[model samples]
Target: MALVHLKNAGITDPTKIDESKTKAVRLASEKVGKDLYRQIYDITFIEKNGPRIEVITSSEASAQECSMSGVDVFVVSRRLGGP
Candidate 1:
């Protein structure tokens, strides 16, 4: 599971999600070396002026990995939560 908190308004433009923003949505590993990783999933905008922002995660497997595996993938921006 993974969670991300943004200090500012995140890019909502589907066409503007360049390399930098796209790189954040992934998992890291160290089995072979430090910080080794793979792109497990990708994010895309389906509609404009959505009610709420969403982050979608996917896993390639036949069965669920854990009971609470995908329960914590969320984003919290400072704009919604005052300091």
Candidate 2:
């Protein structure tokens, strides 16, 4: 399993994020990495109007990580070069 970063692309209010919830998400990601050095990526927060995150992994896993992080993911249709 690989780790992927997910950005918020349509978040109207990032400040509305629950601190504890956010922390939990981070912790979970960390735990996942502890067992397996999954390729981890950081999700950068952009403008509130256009919340977007870029993940460096398979789209399927990316979506799963996003769901676990409590973030809605809108993956752009494209193919990544790799095996």
Candidate 3:
């Protein structure tokens, strides 16, 4: 998967940001199931003025699950040399 730095995303308007969040949630719900979304809430983050997401998880499976569901995630575990 490719990683995108937040600053270069080019979205700054509040309405568009909210729209993106809504679309992300909808896509995730359809692709990953609404029930499972609650299960992974600890690893997900949606912001208003800043980076829209900041997903950090220790589980590769969970990260991949979000990725397949169209949510960007970052896996940081001891196995990957993360503290």
Among these predictions, the greatest TM-score belongs to 1
Candidate 2 to native Cα RMSD, angstroms:
12.1
- Writing each residue's lDDT as its tens digit, candidate 3 over 13-59 gives 33434444532122222223433442232232345655544334221
Model 2 is weakest, by summed lDDT over 10 consecutive residues, at: 19-28
Worst 10 residues of 1 by lDDT: 29-38
- For every candidate structure, what is the RMSD over all alpha carbons to the true structure, in angstroms? 10.8, 12.1, 12.6
Clashing pairs counted in every model: 0, 6, 0
Q: So what's the TM-score on candidate 1?
A: 0.23
**Candidate 2: lDDT of 75?**
39
| CA deviation > 4 Å runs, candidate 1 | 1-11, 24-60, 63-73, 78-83
Instruction: Sort every candidate by TM-score, greatest first.
Output: 1, 2, 3
Question: Candidate 2, residues 1-83: lDDT per residue as tens digits?
Answer: 11122213432344533333221122123334423323233233334344332323321124345433323333334446854
